[model samples]
Target: MKFAVDPWDPTYGTSLGTELGESAAQVALDVELPSSEWQPIDPDPWVVPPDAVLFVDGVRRVDAQVWVDDGGAEAAPALCASYAAGVVCCCKDGAHLLTADVRRGLFTTADAADDVRTTAGTYRATRTAPHPDVAPAQLLSLALQRELADTELAAAAAARGGHDSVHGGADDLLVIDGPLRGRQHLPRAIGFVKSHRSDYLPPQLGGVVAALRTGQRTPVFRLGSSWERHTWYLRLPCRPGAPWAGVVRVECSADLSAGEAVGHAARSQATLPRFASTEYKDSRAPQNLYPIAGLERELRRRLGEPNLLYRALRRAAAA
Candidate 1:
């Protein structure tokens, strides 16, 4: 599964007209999937072949988790920072106890020279924040929104002549981390995906509907505020019947998420495209900022386990 997007596509939900509070209220009710017809995915998170592909339908980031750690000195924020180590992480689902030795832990990508390295923590830590400026809950929400936005923005920017030709290549799954909603951004994204139903997404969202038609891998999601909360997003294979269309949500919440560590990787073994990343490492610029090419090479090299780059994830996950 591949995602070819259109950066020019009007960014909805960001502008006015709809009150932010009301918009959230509108999404309050869970868009129910006709369970009788749509089959949810297996809650037990599994691994996809390293070569798997993902077509991101759309991403709507509700920065609600920020509130979970609104107070810089809040308990949730501290806990979020501690768990950001990539093990024993918490979310809305409960707890996801990750074992560094068992899971990929983090993903590193270095530039050609391997001078500057960037390691995006693979497991729970990727979503945690230890600084007072960014509380854990707030950062987690932002991470979800930003990562998905990177994929969407990248595909859109990479499209050619109004047609997105990116991830059309046949692969296993195209994972877009989020939930499903009919209206708002979710519905609009689905519309685009259905239009591009060919190898990649059709003019609109052909790829999205196709994923629904052909059962997609149950997308693994972490509960933003609490790692303990585990929600599974599975597009029923062929959608079983009409009306109960593409994308199904499976609630696999538990008292703790410690055991399901191995299944929490962002992208396993597949070719990782360049993502507009968070301000994880880049704090100052010019005087202190790393060069663009240098950053890329270092980022890739450090994160690329096959090479010798700074192993931030290994250290963090173990912490």
Candidate 2:
């Protein structure tokens, strides 16, 4: 028997799981190369790294769960959530936070729900009609996630607007810390997925991903279903471990030509490994790049103290 220890801390869960469900989306393996020709592609040494790399991420917390009384037969359930999004730009001058936006929201389905104000902060009421497919709590959580995504978009835009002022005539690449679902319209942006939940490729193709060496990537493939995007897997620099250790999935808008997607794949291989974190520094090292880890800390800090916020909510409810 043979086995390998996953470098990622167990508390955070393994980077890749053995039980992966098949993805619902349709995958086209021929986008960059036919399935028969699948293999690891090394980084293009000629592919120049962007002058600046913008790392975007968001953090959210459920401060408290509350009930909203709106004169209805039954009280409506609501959640008080604090979420924040931000961007950090890395360039010749070094990494600096470019933009950060913190927001609080009372997510509920109650029509009479209004903005919640507390000494700690205000959670503007965000009403979403209940859906049969989702539970109330899950719906509220989804609403909070959507708000965070929107904030991330705005923060990225703000960062791009001001980026040139700091580094004149510099080309920049935008790396969003999650799926590019709603934000695919952004130019020069790619989603950096740190973990795997679904098996998007067949065993033969998956072997290619596992075979990828540090700073190498699989051929680009198109995933289509509810959404469409070009995606590939890359391995970050890390000690030898599990077959799938140090792997990360990168995605770009499907609007790009296959050649363009391949170019982005090359660029990612050439660039992202430089920011890979070490096990001693991060529980989710390698896949969770250094800038993103730092940005997450800053964003969580901006969310304020959860205990104090919860106390304030309690007081507001009593009043």
Every model's TM-score: 0.23, 0.97
Going through the candidates in the order shown, the clash numbers are: 65, 0
| Lowest-sum lDDT 10-residue window in model 1 | 78-87
> What C-alpha lDDT do the candidate models reach, one value each?
0.27, 0.91
For the record, the alpha-carbon RMSD of candidate 2 to the native fold, in angstroms, is: 1.2
Q: For residues 1-319, write the lDDT of model 1, one tens digit per residue.
A: 6543222113332111122121111111121222223332332334444332222322231211211223345324211111100112122343222211111221111111111123533333233334568645555555554454444444422321122233243233223323322111221111111111112111232233334433343333333331233333333222133322333333323332433411332222111112112223422111111222232243233223432222442343245
Candidate achieving the largest lDDT: 2
Per-residue lDDT tens digits of candidate 2, residues 1-319?
A: 8888888888877778768878889999999889999999988879999999999999999999999997989999999999999999998889999999999999999999999999998999999999999989889888888898999999988888888776674798999998988889888999999889899998867889888888889999999989999999999999986889999999999999999999988999878999999989998888889999999999999999999999999999999
Leading candidate by TM-score: 2
